[model samples]
Target: MDTAVTSTPKPVALITGASRGLGAAIARELAPTHDLLLGARSADSLRPILDELPGATGWPVELTDYRAVAAASASIARLDVLVHNAGIADLGTIAESSVDQWRNTLEANLIAVAELTRVLLPALRAADGHVVLINSGAGLRAHAGWASYAASKFGLRAFGDALRLEEQSLRVTSIHPGRIDTDMQREIRAHEGRDYRAEDFLTASTVAAAVRNAVDTPRDAHPTEIVLRPF
Candidate 1:
């Protein structure tokens, strides 16, 4: 008698802004169990992460480019997870902010996210996927100098809330992490004229672990939100 062995196909996860920082950490966390589609603005930027995780494929597209985003999302027939992590934080007070600054911030952080999620809805529905939005503490509280960035994040939180209610079969989680110790955080510190201290902020891996835990939660429980702040 002959016996046959079958192997299960790994789940697929697409992570935007996966070339570095928290996005890259999330990719590393999920790489062992999920086949990854790592998104970055350019193939050159995504190369190092792609090399590190041989199982992942590069998805190079500007999120603000709706045409490019739609084209890229079309190739995915069944997506198990979609992590929206790409965003910009051009910090400025309302008095200092220009029309162009607000437009660019909203375009990258809010509009692009909505468009990408909209285009990938069909694929997500097919697999009863989980959508993870890497939000920020700014989403919950607005600081004086962070008007534009905070507004965009607040809009994102609303989007996630609406999505969770709208898509009954899918799970939508909004992860509100405080200032993380990432390259972005370094830039933010520089902008504020504060000394960069990695110890003062949440590590990318710690936040990434929170994401993985949410993704791994039992279907019976819905992890709608996860808030992480450094102690």
Candidate 2:
């Protein structure tokens, strides 16, 4: 036998909102096991993750830009994992919420996710990939001041449910994690006019690990929905 070596291809994982906070943590967690494609608003936004995970590539494309997302998806012939972690939280009671706010929330959280997933179906099908939707507790129970955010998350929950039912060859998991200790949480707390306590929220690493667990689970086991809370 000749002295030759065959390199094993690593699984591919693309994570949005991966520049900082929970997305970055997820990127770090999956870096060892997957070939990461970190997505953010701009290539510059992904620089931090690129620095953290040397093997990861920065994929800058606005998730809402259908044309851009489609073009990006076209290049992904085989995707092992697609983690939808990008979203916005605009806190306002239903009465105080504006039409624009609702539209923006839905557009960022639900529509973009749907569109991205739709375009990536072929790549996902080719690899029998996993889709992880980083939902929130708001997705399950709406709070008073989180109308727009909750509605978007609720819509996301429905989207994931439908996708799971439709994509027979792929695995879909809607991770409804409670408030994580991230910049987003800081903003939400500011909206509440309260002091930020890191202990009160779950860690980003914890949530990332949960996502990894879902992805690494045996193919025979389907992790449809997983709820994680701080307590």
Candidate 3:
């Protein structure tokens, strides 16, 4: 009789907005090595991919709700990585954008992520985990129609930076992924201009690979920020 028992993986990652696009790509990239806990608005959209991954679990979550995020955190035993990638972009001049649109964008892009990080910090601290904030070039610079989106991302970047200082023992990375070929980019093109070349956009897979690299790096060495711009 063979009594050998296989050991489970050590590092575990929890990623928000894992249904599709950059989030999905990141989840796929990490699925091979880490146990992934994916959260998105719809379980139906996440199930297909989650089923394919060996060590993964999916939870349908509306990130804007603080209670829901807190509930999700309670279920997680330990976490080695937290990817705050759930965000909504609203493009328009400050005057042109509706009040509701601005509020919704801020709620999803900034406030919710902040709340989730607050709830999950204990677990992350225990594991000495890495926290990856999916930021944008807009966070670093201002653009014409990026009033709301840019403001939200800029706030998030500030939060990530401050949090990094607070948690000196943990790794914090804020990545500004430029022009990814995702639905978000398509929306930008539709509202902004079609003159921008899709070919120049970075693939979600590329951003995903970068995320995995950050997670796999040595604990002592931490890359504070990385800006990936496609040529």
Candidate 4:
């Protein structure tokens, strides 16, 4: 019914770890306006979300695979929004945590993020895009048992900070939110020997809204860092 000869193309937004949890929530929030690129570890995992959201493509790849990420960036000529939402939290005290856990956490949370952003810089620069890092409350302050995860998030915060300083044209943000009612939280609760309490945590939708708000903010102003605590 609505036929304009040359309509402006919608801005493209790519969200990693978008198969579920906060990543899926972000995809839903942006679906109304943006051309979404839903990224996940497996295409099968993305089937459900792709079915629910029209016109969104599922990009399945290992973030740690530098070659694959480089190739994926090539397909995206212009990226308006890039969300670093894929991360793993290894919760344990320094004494209890192994070297492998620390390495794995840093590899996924910080190194991969940096690598992806580096590869995508050309596309982001073409659009003057915004980069959003989904950091944790632990990023601001490390908890006793969450040393390894906190370290990785803290590193992520630093990465965003440095990116903001180095790239004058791009907007970089670090979002620090408290524990959300996610499957990841359930796994954390099991490790802590506590009952899963969904009511006591932030919902993914709420956090996703915060992300959308930042993206919608006026270009004249930059929302550098946003922190969200459960209410």
Candidate 5:
């Protein structure tokens, strides 16, 4: 008897917060093979990067808005990978944090991730795509005056874990990347000082490389989660 063989399809990846920092890095790293849909709140920020990459489309959508995310998701074809890297870190203790600050943190970090995943799950399921959640070390450990940001990340970690189980066939990984020297980290360092050591910081490109590795790994194998911290 003779057996037939088939080639697998090239994957498509949709990344949130692709304007700059880690999101932009992931887009650049994945541009070689994946058809990319880059989503962010600012169209201008994405235009230059999208212009440089091939087979990449830029859609400016606030992930916090479920309707906008849903509409944006509808415009895309089947997705082979989903990277949820868009997040905001608002600094404040639980008591000192304003109500608006807490709301904004939840909206940007937690709610947006959940809603965007819900919107994009169908497309991902159709292609057996992977979902990557960009979380933070704050999620795993407590810190001073980091209540809102920490809570948001913690929620995201739990959400990703639960979703991974629900989508047993799809690959879902939550990554805890310690202090990357992005604007986000700069802000945190400005307030925290030596607490966030400058020498012990990873570049956005490094995190992007990790994301690419996760996506490029064999489909038959799934790495549940990865914790990447600067050594």
Candidate 6:
């Protein structure tokens, strides 16, 4: 008889828009237990986070470029977690919006996400992975001047719901967070002509922690949706 011990391989997680903000925070939170694939539009953009997390690899590909996304995702034979955090907020009322604005917004936020998830379904299924969508409160409600952005998020939430039903082995989580304090929030405030107050919005770390919690939940219980708001 012989006795031997071998370490299990760490689970793999891929986070889009991981160059900064909530994506990076979630990467940091999962680094200890999982090998990370940090995705951004360009390698240059991913350099900083890749440097911060030496164990992470850069996955540079524009999500809307379906050819590039398919090629890029081919290398992953198995994936434990997939976080859809990349999205555009091209806010405008229906009257003010253009064909191009609506097309671009949906292309980036909804279609691209669907394409990525479709391509990665095999890999995710292999690992019985978890999918996390970083949605906004706009997903739950539409506000004036936010038609396009809100539509994309609402679609995202619907997508998550569909995926949960379709992929019974995989866990799908939609994190619907209120305004978050980040550079994006600042820009949104500037567009609204309002003051940028960090206290008024949720912190990136807090949202990331919520993601970590969903990912860490026991296998017996599925974490389907997590709604977050600032105090």
What's the TM-score of each model vs. the native? 0.99, 0.98, 0.93, 0.97, 0.91, 0.98
List residue ranges in candidate 5 displaced over 4 A.
1-9, 193-198
Best by TM-score: 1
Determine which window of 10 residues in candidate 3 has minimal summed lDDT. 190-199
lDDT by candidate, in order shown:
0.96, 0.93, 0.87, 0.94, 0.86, 0.94
Q: Model 6 compared with the native: what TM-score?
A: 0.98
lDDT of 2 by residue, 117-206 (tens): 999899999999999999999999998998889989999999999998999999999999999999989988898999999999999999
lDDT string, candidate 3, 42-73, tens digits: 88889777777746888788887778778878
Error of 1 at 177 (Å): 0.5
lDDT of 2 at 26: 95
Query: What residue runs in model 1 are displaced by over 4 Å at the alpha carbon?
Result: none
In terms of lDDT, which candidate is strongest?
1
Whole-model alpha-carbon lDDT for candidate 6: 0.94
Q: List candidate 6 segments past 4 Å from native.
A: 1-4
Question: Which pairs, if any, clash in model 6?
Answer: none
Q: Write the per-residue lDDT of candidate 1 for residues 1-231, one digit (tens) a residue.
A: 899999999999999999999999999999999999999999999999988998899999999989889888888999999999999999989999999999999999999999999999999999999999999999999999999999999999999999999999999999999989999999999999999989999999999999999999999999999999999
Pairs with steric clashes in candidate 2? none
lDDT of 5 by residue, 117-137 (tens): 888878888888799999999
Looking at model 5, residue 145 earns an lDDT score of 92
Tell me the alpha-carbon RMSD of every candidate.
0.6, 0.8, 1.9, 1.9, 3.5, 1.2
Candidates by lDDT, descending order: 1, 4, 6, 2, 3, 5
Model 2, residue 211: distance off in Å is: 0.5
Candidate 2 differs from the real structure by a C-alpha RMSD in angstroms, to one decimal, of 0.8
